[model samples]
Target: MSKTVGVIGGGQLARMMIPAATNLGLTLRVLAEKEGEPAALAVTALGSHLDVEDVLRFAEGVDVVTFDHEHVPQAVLRELVARGVNVQPSPDALQFAQDKLLMRERLAELGVPVPDWARVVSSEQLARFLADHGGRAVLKTARGGYDGKGVRVVRDASDADDWFAAADGEALLVEELVEFRRELAQLVARRPSGELALWPVVESVQRDGVCAEVIAPAPHAAGKVADVAADIATTVAEALGVTGVLAVELFETTDDRLLVNELAMRPHNTGHWSIDGSTTSQFEQHLRAVLDLPLGATGCRDEWSVMVNVLGGPATGAVTDRYDLAFADQPTVKFHFYDKAPRPGRKIGHVTAGGDDLDLTVFSARAAAAFFDN
Candidate 1:
């Protein structure tokens, strides 16, 4: 019997991990919510992560259960562990990634630098936080939030009144609007045996709260910035007892301080460039970490690597339809497309370009991605 790895979500992360698992001779199984998800190739079960019975049935066949996303409920995860199923990045560690409020509390305990935050269940409490912090703040739901979803910026507390009403007394996490010069993400892999490795910190560019592009080893982040980013990721991985790839989204504040912005306990959008530019992609490293296997080297294959996401692919037909143009225009670029349908703001695919010249790499990556624009 082959070592089987079960993924709880059938999104693009799982889709990308399938090839890495196959290369290692492991059977990758995904419990997707429905048919036709991106990880359709490896989807062995059609089930919901929120349904305990569905997850339990899926986990019975795999050697270890991991995740493609952090949305799995704690009750379901805990049940798997109780039944003697091996779950990497156990529910205890994953809760921090699942709930922004809990994440803030735990990071605070770990002495991690983060934006000033408060848990507000009422409009009065939100207004007070607004007054204390600059009359404006970033509001977020404590759970089930990702990308640009469940997050908003508001100057008036009333702007979030509908959310408060919808919360049904559940507290929302509100943070002081950060003054960031740029966003950076540090990718780290940790195995259950306590070994850890980190990739160079990369700068992430955001458009409408969604990651648009990423530049590896963030330009000019050679000294203090890179060092600090790596240190933060290492600390969190160790303190939180996280196993598998951990992505620490950070804000390089205008004042030169690096603050934790968000956390992901799976392969993240920022680290997608590693598939083409690093000696070991995050997908491969994630599999190794969860299985407690030796980690691969994290060295860069080029001086610079730029990854640009293809958003809302071509208005008509599929992304494949425009590949002729993209491939011809940017021969040096490598493309990875999710077999997802085209929709506004949806991430259909991405292109990565690596070269000694940073400007050329960036231009090539962006050009390839633009061909898929709607």
Candidate 2:
């Protein structure tokens, strides 16, 4: 019998999973947030992921439950597990991703390399942390922050007064502002049965705190750096008891050291290039991992692959309207659209280009992605 996999959120991640599930002959069901959300077309049911009754109905008959996003409430997830549903990356491991303070505390216990950080419950506490960290620090809500939201760089306590006021006396997290040479991402997929697969460590380019591009097998990542990255990712996966794809976002310092910046237990934006540039896409590997199937090879298809996100631009128009131009200009570039309306800075699509030369591949992808900007 074909096993059914239920995804708890309807976003681009779930949308991308449709093709992989179809190819694997698996049934893919999504508990979409809205009637016509990005992954709605691929869903078997429609409802908010937060609704216990609705989620219970969606999980009925599904062999395993996964996620498109990590925002699902812990109460709802725990309820599902209590009901005997198979939830990969169980709530115990997921709480770290859901709450940064918990993540830092756990990583610290494991002796993981992380930046200086502290938990702050008041403006005075934040001021003390900032004083210890060069008088400037990054403050983040322990829960519910992404894409530059709920994060701020503050030079003094007054800078974060609003965040403190909004927290209703709840504690927030503060960390030293990292002075890194560049950002790196390591993606690892692990199965319930202890099988693991790893992809090359890649360089991620961020603009205004949002990832704009990724270069597979990061430039100049040769011996020790690559090995340490892989080791860190592997260790993190085993330590956290994470199943499915786990993305470890790291900061590669100028002095040649690595620091754990963040963690995402899902097919991440950094691995999006694997769709056409790897022997196996992260989406496919994620499914195989959750289902406890033998993993696929993680080799790159070309010497270099560059993925540039096609963020919504100033001019408003459908992504398809620029496809003809993009294809005609760069036939080798591969485009993946998420059936979303264009909005400034939103990720509506992406273009991946691979070849023997990194510069040319990057140029190709950027050109194709830029065509949509107008």
Q: Write the per-residue lDDT of candidate 1 for residues 1-374, one digit (tens) a residue.
A: 78889999999999999889989899999999999999999999998999999999999968899999998899999999999999998999999999999999999998999999999999899999999998999999999988899999989999999999999999999999999999999999999999999999999999999999999989999999999999999999999999999999999999999999999999999999999999999999999999999999999999999999988888998778898888899888999999999999999888999999998888888888889887
Cα error, candidate 1, residue 149 (Å)? 0.7
lDDT of 2: 0.91
- Residues 38-106 of candidate 2: C-alpha lDDT, one tens digit per residue: 887778888888899999999999989999989989999999999999999889889989999999999
Error of 1 at 185 (Å): 0.2
Best by lDDT: 1
**lDDT score of residue 294 within candidate 2:** 95
TM-score of each: 0.99, 0.98
Candidate 2: where are CA atoms >4 Å away? none
Which residue pairs in candidate 2 collide?
Answer: none
Candidate 1: global Cα-lDDT? 0.94
